[model samples]
Target: MNLIEKAASRINQGDALSADTAALRSQASPADEPPHAPLVQRAQARAAEVPVHAEAPSAESEQEIAERHVSRQITIDLERLRAAGMITPDDDKHQLAEEFRLVKRPLITNAVEATSSDRNRNLIMVTSSLPGEGKSFCSLNLAISIAMERDRRVMLVDADVARPSLLGYLGLQAERGLMDLLLDPNLQMSDVLLRTNIDKLSILPAGRGHKHATEFLASESMSNLLDEMANRYPDRIIIFDSPPLLVTSEARELAAHVGQVVMVVESGRTSQDAVKEALRQLEGCDIVNLLMNKGSSTPLDGYGYGYGYGYGYGYGRSGRS
Candidate 1:
C-alpha cells in the first residue's frame, strides 16, 4: 500500500503507532523518512476519524476588528460618542441604549438602530457647514455603522466631487468611479460599485472631478442612478457624502434627489450662522435627524457628554448628589 493509504487505514483502524515507534519497527533508517511524515499520517488519521467544516467569522467579531483597525487612525473613541452626553437621566443615547441593549455595543449600533426601520432605506445627505468639520468621517462612519447590520445593504456615494475621501479611506486606487459612470451613462451601477472588506458596504467614488460638478450632480443621470439604486437594493441604505452645504450648493442640490438631509455640525468651530444657513438651504428636504459631531470632549473628571456608553461624568445620581 502507498504511505498515504497505509496512514488512512491505520487511522481508520484506530491502531496507529507513534512516529518513533513506527520508525524503530520500519527497516528504513530514521534519515530516510521525511521529517513531517509522522505528522502528516496523524493528521490524515484525525481527519478520517472526524469530519469538520470551516465557517466565516461572526458579524460581531468582524465589526470589532473593523473598529479596532479603522479607529486607530483617529483619536476619536467610539465609546466616547455614546457616553459623552448627560448622566442627568435625560441623555438620548443612554436612554436608547438602555432600552435597546445597544449601548454597550459600538456607536454604530446607535446609528443603525436609528435608521433601521425606514422603508425607504433613507437616501440621507451628509454635509457640514464648513470644511474640516469631519463630515467625511461622519459619512464613512455612518455608512459602516449601517452596513454592520446583517439585514441591511449600504451604498456610499462620493458626491463630494471637489475632494473625495472614500477611496483614500479604503486604501484603493482606481482610475474609474462615479465620474466614469456619469461620463458613460450606459455603464451598469454594479460596474462602478466597489465592494469593501467590510461586509454589506459598497462605495462609488467620485470618478473624476469636473469643472461643473454642481451641474453634473444635479443632472437627470445622477437622479436616475439614485432611482436605480433604490429600486435595485430596496433594503440597502444609500448615503451620499457631499460638499459642505454652505460652501457649495452641491449638497443642497443633491438633497432634492435624496429627500432627507442629515446635517453634521462640528461643535466649537462651526458658527451658528453657517449652521442656520445650511439648515435653511435644506429647509425643503426631509431631515432624518441632526447630529452634533465632535461636540465636546469628556470633562476632566470623566463626566461629560454621554457618548454611546453613558454620561461618564454624570453617572448615578447618588454619586452626584
Candidate 2:
C-alpha cells in the first residue's frame, strides 16, 4: 500500500472510547443537530459548492515539500497522557478518551464537509474564558483524537503566543513556529513544524513570544499562512490552541481568520458572566462550540477527570480534563 494508505490501515485497526457525563450519549438527540444558541452571524452554509482552484501548488503538495524543511518526528508520553485521563490509543475504552470521541465527531463532520465557509471552516480554535480552565488540556486531546481518525491528519498549532503549553504538555521539544514566520520573512514553515510519532498528527509550536504577538497574529503574513494550510491537504484538519478571550486580545485577532471557535468552560469555577464576555469577544465568528470540562461526575468510576464532556452548538467537545 502507499504510505498514507498504509498509515490509515494501521489507525483504523487501532481505535474505539467511553466518557461519564450523564449526557455523554444518553441525551444525544436522535438527530445530530446539536443544541446551541443561534449564531450572531452564521457563515453561508455552502455545503454544495466546491472550492475554487489555487494558482500555486498547495502546502502539502509533493512538489512544495521538495524544497520545504523536512519535518522532524518526535514522540509523546502516551502513558503520561493516559494517566492524566487524556485520550490514548492503548486505552480508548477510558471514559475521558471515549468522551473526546463524541466531542470530535461533529467538528470533524463540519470540517470535512465540501464547502467554502466564511473562512477556512476546517480551522478550529480552542480557547477558554481565562487561563487554567483546561483549554490546553482539551486542545491537545482533541488534536490527538482527530489524528487517530482513520481518514484524517491533524495539524495542532500552539497559537497562544503570550504563553504556550502544548509542546511542554506533549513532552516534545519546541523550536521556531508561527511567530517566527511572521517576524522573520526568511523563516519557512518546515522550520517550525514537528511531525510526531502519532500516525496522523503534526504540531507547530508558538515560536518565540513576540511583544506584538497580537499584532503578528492579525498580520497579512498570518492570513497567508492560514490560507495555505487550509488548502494544503484535503484530508488535513488544522487546529489552533488559542489564548483565552477574557485574558488576551490575541484570541479575538486569531478568530477573524478561522471559521469555527470552541470555548472551554471549567465545570464549576467559570462564572456565567465570564462565559458571556468570552462569547462577546468572538461576536463575529460563524460557529462556536462549548465544552464543559471537569464536570460533576465520571461516567466510569475507576479513572479520574470528572470532566463530563458535552457538545453544544455542535462541537461540545474537548481533550482530557
Candidate 3:
C-alpha cells in the first residue's frame, strides 16, 4: 500500500494519529494493490463527522486573489538588508538578527499559549514613543525575522494611518488594505494583501488614510476584520506597524484590539518622560513589551558578554492598567 493507503487504513480502523506519530508504515510495499477506493471510503467517513449544515467556504472573487498579489513582487535587496542589520535567513548569524530572535521568543510563546483567553496574542502591534524612534525599523525587522521560522507565516500590516511608510520601505507602490476593508463592505482581505516572493511573508498596506481614523479603528467592522485575521490561520503572526503612541489616536485605539504591544524606545534619543507617557497611552493592553533601540554597546562584562539591546515585557505592568 502507498502512503495514502496506510492513512486510509488507519482512518478506517478508527485509529487517530498522534502529533509525533509517523504517517505511514514502512511495511506497506510499493507493489501492494492500489488502495484508492479504500482511501475514498475513509475520506467519506471522516466527512461524515463534520456537521452537515456547516457553512461552506466563502466564495472569494478572482479579483480578490489577483489584487492580493501584484504583477511583480518587490525583491528585497540582500545587501541592503545586511547593511541595515535586518534579518535574512540566508545571511550568516548576525548580532542584530540574534538579538531579534531572542526578542521574538516571548511574543511567540504568548501567541501559542492556548490557555490565554485573548485571541489577539498573535496580533502584535509595534509602535514608538514618537516618530524616528525606530518603531518602523523594528516592526519590519521583527516581521521578517519571524517569517524566517519554518513553521510561521508573517502578515505585516501597515497600521500607521497617519504616515504609511511600509510600501516605501519595501520598495512597493500604494495598495489598498486595512482601511479599505473597513470603508468598503464589498472588499475581502484577500483583495488587498500584497503577496511577496519572500517564502512566508505578506504585506497589507494601510489603505487610504481615513479622516476619522481612530473611529474606524475602534469600529465593529474593524473588530470583525481583526478576528478574521486572527483565526483564519493558526500559524500566522500578524504584526502591525502602528503610528507613534503619543502622536496618533489611531495607535492608542489600535491597542484596544491587540493582545500584545511592543513600544519602541530609542535608547539615547527618546526621553524617559516620553517613554513613560507613550506607555501610559497603552493603558488597557494586558501585555506590553518594551523594546529599547539604539542603546550603547559595551564590551564583555561580568556576565562574559555584553547585551547590546534592552527589552521589557509584561502583563499590564507596562503602563497597561
lDDT top scorer: 2
- What tens digits encode model 2's per-residue C-alpha lDDT throughout 163-220? 8888887666667888887888766666667877777788888999889888888889
Q: 1 or 2: which has the higher TM-score?
A: 2
User: Clashes in candidate 2: how many?
Assistant: 6
For residues 170-211, could you state the per-residue lDDT of candidate 3 as single tens digits?
567788878888898876666677777676788888999789
lDDT (Cα, tens digit) per residue for candidate 1, span 136-233: 66566567556656566667788888888766644456445677777785665545556555566667778888888788778998777676665544
lDDT of 1 at 56: 40
> Order of candidates by lDDT, top first?
2, 3, 1
Q: Which regions of candidate 1 fall more than 4 Å away from where they truly are? A: 1-121, 297-321
lDDT (CA) for every model shown?
0.51, 0.68, 0.67
Of candidate 1, the 10-residue stretch with the lowest lDDT total is: 312-321
**How high a TM-score does candidate 2 get?**
0.75
Q: What is the lDDT, from 0 to 100, of the residue 35 in candidate 2?
A: 16
TM-score of 1: 0.58
